[model samples]
Target: MDKHSIEKEFTALIQQYRNVIWKVCYIYAKDRENLNDLYQEAIINLWKGFPKFRKESKPSTWIYRIALNSCITFFRRFSRHPQTLRLTESWDFAYEENVFSSQIQELYALIHCLGNIERALILLWLEEKSYAEIAIITGLSQTNVATKLCRIKEKLKKMSNQ
Candidate 1:
């Protein structure tokens, strides 16, 4: 529709699903600065894509696709550069305290080591999205989603054991 209507609708959509956007970014974030950068990129991508979003899928599904794709792209783009310094320890604990148990926090740490698509698949599974819904967001068949999730879980188990 009009510019105002589009802005209003986009605002409402972002407000309603900001947590989803943040969670996707959080999963990929290396630190606070990276998290902020990923979030900004996701917001810009969402705005650019909103005008063409069809009603063929749920808004959250569309959001997940956009947020995940944006963060993954942003991450890959930055990863090509060499860093002269690195954080000695992850600041993940700062975010996890009082929010998640140690076990869950450890799981998240292991998740960070996963390949980009694997991390996205597990994050969708953890969000309790239906297999069909995840399939739509991930552009995978339902059976493929199920199979990949099974493998991801097993991979997580193996990582956790080590």
Candidate 2:
């Protein structure tokens, strides 16, 4: 396709799935500034990978892979950023007020304490993606996704109790 077509298609898809992008960013980001940076990075990564999209998966699936990978990369490279580990307190109120109920807001707090991949899995799970679907999006086996989610749920229980 030509440049204009690519840009137009990319823009439409991005706009259509922007909430998914933002949710991934919101999960990984530590604060407002980090959210902004992660959002930009996710968008750039999506653009760069757009030309190579093979259409073997749904667009949302493809977008999830790109956004999650971008967030993981951003976290690793900028681990020392003040906002890097700020996912909990900063988002607690915002989530309760604007997004999640108190129950899920607490879950988000616990989720921040988990590793990047685990966090991604929980986010996908919370979004009600099937184990097979999450496996495809996350590049894990369906069994592995199930096992990890079980462990994550146990961990969440432990964390919430304390």
Q: Model 1 Cα displacement at 57 (Å)?
A: 0.9
- Encode model 1's per-residue lDDT on 1-162: one tens digit a residue: 899999999999999999889889888887778888888999999999998998788999999999999988987877965222121334543342247656666777788888889989999999999999999999999999999999999998887776
What does candidate 2's lDDT look like per residue over 87-148, in tens digits? 24546235213767667666666787788998999999989999989999999999999999
TM-score of candidate 2 on Cα atoms, chains taken together? 0.89
Lowest summed lDDT across 10 adjacent residues in model 2 is found at: 81-90
List lDDT for all candidates, in order. 0.85, 0.85
- Whole-model lDDT, model 1: 0.85
Quote each prediction's TM-score.
0.89, 0.89
